[model samples]
Target: MKLSHLLPALIWLMAGSLCAAPPHSDVRIASPWPAQNTILAMLGYGENIVGTSMVAKKIPLFRQSLPRIDSVPVVSVNSGHELNPEQIISLGTQILFVPSSMTVPQQDLLRQAGVRVLAFDANSLQALTSRVQKTADALGPDAQDKAQRYQHYFDRNVALVKERLKGLPQDQRITLYHSMGNPLTTTGRPSLNQDWMDLAGAKNVAENWFAGKQNRRGEVALEQVVAANPAVIVAMNKRDADAIQTTSQWAQVDAVVHHRVYVNPKGMFWWCRETSEEALQFLWLAKTLYPDRFADVDMRQETRRFYQDFFAITLSDAQISDVLNPPQ
Candidate 1:
């Protein structure tokens, strides 16, 4: 046990320990949506993803490459069975990321299975930023730098929105529809889209009766929209926007006739990747609805800056446009 002899043994042990530490290049993860997958990929952890839910595979980036668990709830599913707890654990995921709508049973199952479940809230722009940082922290040291960068862009983007909306008169604020799905459903007060629209200085008409309701899919008659006469109509997806324009039944609405229709892309899951694409959609909606107030703001350039400063990705104007205006 001479000092020199012990030194070599200690060095050998140290090397083995270093090798034993998990590598950042690969890790098992499960997500409820494709946007989270995209966010992870943007953070340089894309290659690390081992498994994803069916929804995550829809994005072009992961559509072909990832394995589908068929574990996610159908988009039409409003309440229970949204999360397949057994299938999630069967994927052998060390960490599971879920949307904010997780149920009590799902939480119990994850706890029993020893899987770390991180729920992200995309309820508002601020909530989205906090969730992004929390997700980054869960990924350990490899994601530290990327997490800091993500926070930076989030801060910059939100600040600009507040600054732009500060001096707008109440009458100057526009009326918004906050459409979702093929039916062009508007936000019912509790819905995340409604909150975002409010932040952007738009008045959400749907909140009139459905305020604080449990059901987000609350529907109003075409007469309601026609009478409210919103200055602008915000559609969640491109298909929804097109349906409003082409569908005979919807043509009766004032928004369609007035040409106030605005489409927001489904980025990161609009419900969860709250910090990234959802926030971008908010800014885009703000600028689109109130161009005069945000005249100096260039959302495309801002989006590119977000990609560069936060996700470390270089996105061109065409690529950004494609996300904004998906193929019909």
Candidate 2:
């Protein structure tokens, strides 16, 4: 064959091979939700993130987990109600991950700008695991393996907790009241926070009280909380826990009176949320509720292992403690 004829064929073959190659390596992603951002970072796609919301910026561990996170542009829209489509387009984002709560118009705007948008509901354990899988699927084939491993770890941890707490009498289950921030703001039935309480082998005092309500969080009068008199009082952070402890009105509440007030751990994301760290949150909550049953579970070691295995980061003793017990 002539050299000129062979050269054209070779060039065509090269172009075909390049087109067949996967595009995941070049994917530029943006997420306005902190939970989804944490999941993506855990899946080893932190380097692909081109934009983030204000909420993601506030997470110290999230920032620490991704060395290049600061370089990502902030694209929060209307004080977090939506995402900034213009900034996202400007950053060359190929994909945008959002919570299911995002409005249709917000999604439309991004799609019109040529960005593929994925919305996942991470409100329940099932939804959260499914979202993880979906997010991984969007990333590429390599991420599927990570997602499966994560799901297995999550299921195994949950099963371990369940097996250990099997046949626990309902009466013995610790009843907990979750203080959102103030004593009045609390979590109830149908909420992810309540799901955490249930998985931890504890009862939510506000479960039936807010039945049929659309919102997950509601304000319960202080009188009602004192009347319920839960065995444990769980707060999202130390500030709320301290408020519950110091408030004179709650002095007589059983949880406060017995010094059973506890704070949920906060890290890259709130452990209490239905994020990738839910398995750890379940273990922590279970341990806090029934110390005798979970005495063998070293949370510090578990935290270190989860980060190392999933996020590929090794946390120090102090870092683990900070995650398990955040400052006020």
Candidate 3:
């Protein structure tokens, strides 16, 4: 063949290949964020996961729902900020997802090794929904439709809660205290934790407890909690709820006195956190706060349907209970 003729043919072929290829097709992704891992699986990208973090693997829902999860290697200890690009590249990873905390240099290391890097920030509801859509986009066309459906479900429920609580007076809003891992540590100030309370038509006593990005502890003295005296307490677990109930200092708190200490559900990856399951958390809180208003909403049935609809996993009653209480 003539050199000129062969060169033109090759150029045309290369152009066609580039033009026809789907964005992120044949993607092999690894993520250190447990919240992201749960969302990825929910969006039907579980099969593409070649690596994940240890925290994601420990989630009961992942063990039960995603078989590929067991085969995926753990790339980092907690977050993927210090991920080894050589290790990830060797695994044939096309994409690596790190949290917003991941440094630019770390992401650049993977990028230089021919891997795309994506960052997820899941501090707010807006951030969570954006993560869902962006993740679906990265998974190619097949997952886009599923992301849309989930978004619709999320928007519908958010609207329902807003409509139900549209005219709720300030006095009617329940005062809430949400504790995290420890008794004093709560998701204070602006975050999805505070958003949950707002969506549920409740007042958060810890909303202004600790303010600033530098303050990661989110802890307030026990006395401040007693002074606020929340009407309801949403503990990280049943154990925390019990601590508030039985502890002498907490006895005077209104929530403790009224027996309104409820344990937050720990699902795919702590529904209370930035996981896609935050949709359920908002609903659960709405009902928990105003039982009379949301009497028709049953969380157990919603949970079963959510897993079946999104991840195609059917849960037995016992399995559902396991995630809700999640054995101590």
Best-matching candidate per TM-score? 2
Query: Candidate 2 overall Cα lDDT vs. reference?
Result: 0.81
lDDT (Cα) of model 3: 0.80
Residues 1-328, candidate 1, lDDT per residue (tens digit)? 4544443444444345445545545556767555667667656666556555456656542432333423333222225737655555555455777677664245665555555778776655566566667777878676767777666665666788899889889887888776665554555666566667777788877776575566555667777776777777767676777887788776767788887776665433442224355657667788888788789888778767765665555666776776566553
**Per-residue CA lDDT of candidate 3, range 67-145, in tens?**
6688789875425456665566556567777778765444554554456788877678898899899988878777888
Worst lDDT 10-window in candidate 2: 6-15
Report the number of the highest-lDDT candidate.
2
Q: Please list the C-alpha lDDT of all candidates, in the order they appear.
A: 0.63, 0.81, 0.80
List candidate 2 segments past 4 Å from native.
1-22, 104-109
Off by over 4 Å in 1: 1-25, 61-79, 82-86, 104-114, 120-122, 248-252, 266-275
Our model 1 lands, by Cα RMSD against the true structure, at 9.1
**Per-model tally of clashing residue pairs:** 2, 0, 0
- Count backbone overlaps in model 3: 0
lDDT of 2 by residue, 100-120 (tens): 887535455455445688888
